[model samples]
Target chain A: MHFVDRVRQRLDDAELQHNLKRTRGRNAASRAAAVAAFPDFDAVRARATEIRARVLRDLDLWLEAFEAKATESGATVLWARDGEHACELIIDIARRHGVRTVVKSKSMVSEEAGLNAALEAADIRPVETDLGEYILQINDNEPPSHIIMPVIHKSKEQVSALFARVHGTAPKTDIEALTHEARAVLRPQFLGADMGLSGGNFLIAETGSVAIVTNEGNGRLCTTLPRVHVALTGIEKVIPTLEDLSTLLRVLPRSATGQAITNYVSLLTGPRHAGDPDGPEHMYFVLVDGGRADLVGSDFEDMLRCIRCGACMNHCPVYQTIGGHAYGWVYPGPMGSVLTPLYQGLDKALDLPQAATLCNQCSVVCPVSIPLPELMRRLREKQMEQGLRPWRERLATRLWAWAAARPALYAWGARIAVRYLRWLADGRDRIQVMGLAPGWTAQRDFPAPAGATFRDLYARRRQGRA
Target chain B: MSTRDDILGRLRRQLGRTGSGLAEARRRIRDEIDTPRSGPRPSPGDDPERFIGRARAMLSTVDGCATMDEVPAKVAGWLRAQGLTTRLVIAPAFAGLDWSGAGCEVRAGAAGPHDAVGLTGCFRAIAETGTLMLRSGADMPPVNSLLPDTHIAVVPRTCIVPDMETAWTHARAEWRHWPRAVNLVSGPSRTADIEQTIVLGAHGPYRVHLIIVG
Candidate 1:
């Protein structure tokens, strides 16, 4: 579907709006409180940004170190050039272990790779264990609208209806009751699953470990209990040392959910060792390239610093109004505007860069201080340079440029433009009809020019003063 | 050969690096790993009182255990106060704590589906966020604290570190060998998936009771 149509349709959705409204205030308030609690938020953020920049500069070296250390620690580190290659590697691991049921925690990397569908096609049953993710999984495998809260777009009542239909249990309208029902259904799946897949928030090179943070214990359960554990993470996730993990950790949970730290922070180095009573016997770390390398040292390289906190989406005005699905991919909001276009070609997501209002809220709240609006602006410029923008928009830009270069002609054009708009407005403050730009006024009215142009007013004032 | 080279080559190209200059970058990262740098962080001075205060804010129940031997009695009193059964799953790592006087049903081993309360000792207690860092091995299953309805963790007053950075420093200095799994658990497992309202014990412990033992 077109991005504009999706946005229009989403705006009309009362339930989605209600759900977004419920979280918008709470998330923003809690995040503000969490940020207030920190005394050195910006200083620590700068330190983290430097760390990310250092890693990106020497990412290949860090990966080699991580691979060597992980290999020595008895973990097989696999690399993939893209998402399809990532899915293939995961499938191969499943087949080798003769696994059937695979339980997964919330992994945006897997979502980007479409791992669930690939596993299903291979006759492997993939179960989502996170409460929010499980809701989306049972409801026809909808891609997450938010990264941290995958089903933030869903309401409790809708979830109750879903549970009654899917679990064959009575509808649970209360949030706690609904949570318990989900736990009852997923606990057995955790104990009985043959394999587990998770996404790593940070892959530590010093310890050759994969670290994950979750408010729910599902991540721990998925990595434990199951005989085989496979962690699929982006190559950009690798950090040089455990100290770097600490800095990122400080910012991640606070920015993600306004928690000082999530309930569970799992730092797993490798599979279970001899005499160890629990943990997976087999462990594999698949570092997914997935076009992340394409942004290395590019204009949008700072974007790779995102920790999937969902703060960008939480604070974004555009995201709060229209929600995430309208952006048309696993990622959305300000970060998505820059990332989706860069990761998936600019031509593929032409409207994403223009979707943002360029308010810079995401950049200010970002833990790593990524210049998100600046990156989005660059993407727009790239679109113009590559001729990826719509022909009419391009033509309009050209015509404006032609008139703008000649000051007298520009003044003359502005005078005529205001008159035409006022005539269209028919004495109202806003124009109800637009000739060539009907899409702009179709949904709502466009504010009309009041009287003469600003240039004319300034010129008349100068003459009167003289 | 896999796609390692392809991915790395792309990164190297973008970073404007040649084969001859790669060794210097590799050495720098290895040196960084050996002697890690400490960046700006919240100063959580090692104070047991502050730890208790923070833990309380996160909804964890804290009780004072005057000594290691008093853990059993303190836990027994806590369980009774909560109106929960005395039967608890304990990790063999805590055999030194002596839970015989707790007057509670104590089973030792990994957590099972039916266990209501799981008790274990943490590798270190982080005073910054009032979190317990538990490392897997030495007959102490990480799930003993997880995979249960209620979790009772024993945090030694002496083992309390100022923050995560200090915790890692202590782990490196003493542990020598890294445990397969290291979990930093705070309060209890929770979820705000439904309308952003927190519901504790979504899949883990509903209540996390901390006994501050000296």
Candidate 2:
């Protein structure tokens, strides 16, 4: 089935409706609180955009500085041209370290690179320590339903049952109890794992540091307790300095979870130094380009400014109705509509760019101001130019364009269509069983076209008409 | 070309930049980083009372201590009130604070999983966000503030910074060489991943109590 039909099916799923309603309510409150946290939100957004634009303009230099500084700070920096290269570097590290078990923090980059499968193929077990990710990991068929909240589609009762079946214990109905159960299970993994992998939120070029923001303490544990730490990050995550990092941090938590500050914001430079009590002994950074560089100076370069806060999806009516799984990709909502196609080819992900209503809510809520609707429109134009749309839709569009060029033919066509539609309506105001567009009239009636075209109505009014 | 050269070359091509432009960009970044300017930030009014108020509002219990000697009693009392164990793991940096009178069994080192409480002295506390800044060193290790179920931090009132920018200035001035880890912790470890309901202590300390010494 096509993406449209799948979305339509999911739009009516009872389980999905129940899940999305809860998220809508929670997101509404968080967005309100986030808006209230900042005295001058727009000014901060403008500055952030300027900083990102500067970084993107000189991305290669900043990356070079980052590599040099991080190496000086005792970290080994490696560059990967694509996801395959990134995965291979990580697997090779695992092999050399004799890593039997790996504990991972929540990282969208690892998801994009398909690192877990690669590690598994090499006989190394990877454990997801974040509670939401752990749930998705156990249920192999379910991808993350939301970026921040991976198990947004699941309920506590369902989680309870999953724990009981997977861990071989009686299901506990309390929410806190389930959380404690996950902590108990993942603690040993943290203590015993030879290596830990995480995604970088921002790689500071000045301090040779990686800034990670997480509400849960798993990020701190994953980066600290393991002997070897590997951070897989996109090239676009680099900032010029710690001062710049401070500005980005101010907006990130507010935009992400409405917190004045997240519980833990770790600025880790390299690994543990000599005489330091406890941290990773060695550190490695894999900077994955993966098609982001393709948009450096293009019209779509603005999309790279996204901080992955999930605010666009939280405010999107289309996404809230269909949920994230309907988008069928790593990213979802307005950001995903532009990114999925650009990152994973426009041919396979056509429905994503077409899914938006171009309401402009996403643009207003975006922390860095990406102009998402305009980008989506550009993607649609690109798709049409590439001849990726269906032939019937293309033919209809071309016919309308051709008729629209000549007013007399368009007026005549409109008059004939209204007359035929008046007969189809059978004297009723609406037509339920119409051949004009069965998809539109499938569940509800389409209103009859006022019984006269606009030109006819204007002429009749000029002639003292009814 | 190697992968590094290839990746950088592709970026240069897409961005329409020449080799000469690279030197200029590097210089600009270096100048900006050397002379840092603060950006638009929230003005929470950098005062001790406001800092304490904000810290309390974030669910962190803040108690005022007249001197360094008063920190142990407060930690012990808070622990007893909360029914936590009296066996505490103190950071080596804070080994001078007397814990004998507080009636608590104290050990100074990295925190273990079985340790219920860990105490440390913070580098600086920011008033803007009620955040405690901790730097990793021989004296103040990272795990002392993270691994334990309960974290009790002792903050000297003079070490409080007006905002995050001021904290950065202090950090640069004090540690010319940056520490391995610089943590800005605000409140206890928490998560909203479970059906968007906030649950405290997902993997770190469930309770974070602050003892402010004057």
Which 10 consecutive residues of model 1 chain A have the lowest summed lDDT?
Answer: A21-30
On the 0 to 100 scale, the lDDT of residue B64 in model 1 is: 77
What is the lDDT, from 0 to 100, of the residue A332 in candidate 1? 86
DockQ of 1: 0.82
Candidate 2, residues A314-359, lDDT tens digits: the string is: 8888888888888878898889889999999999799998898799
lDDT of 1: 0.89
* Interface Cα root-mean-square deviation for all models: 1.0, 1.1
> Candidate 1 residues A35-70, lDDT tens each?
898888888889999998888888888888888888
Q: Give me the chain B TM-score of candidate 2.
A: 0.95
DockQ of each: 0.82, 0.82
Calculate each model's fnat, 2 decimals.
0.84, 0.86
- Stretches of model 2 off by over 4 angstroms after superposition: A411-435, A443-466, B44-46
In model 1, state the lDDT of residue A205.
87
Quality class of the docking in candidate 2, CAPRI style: high
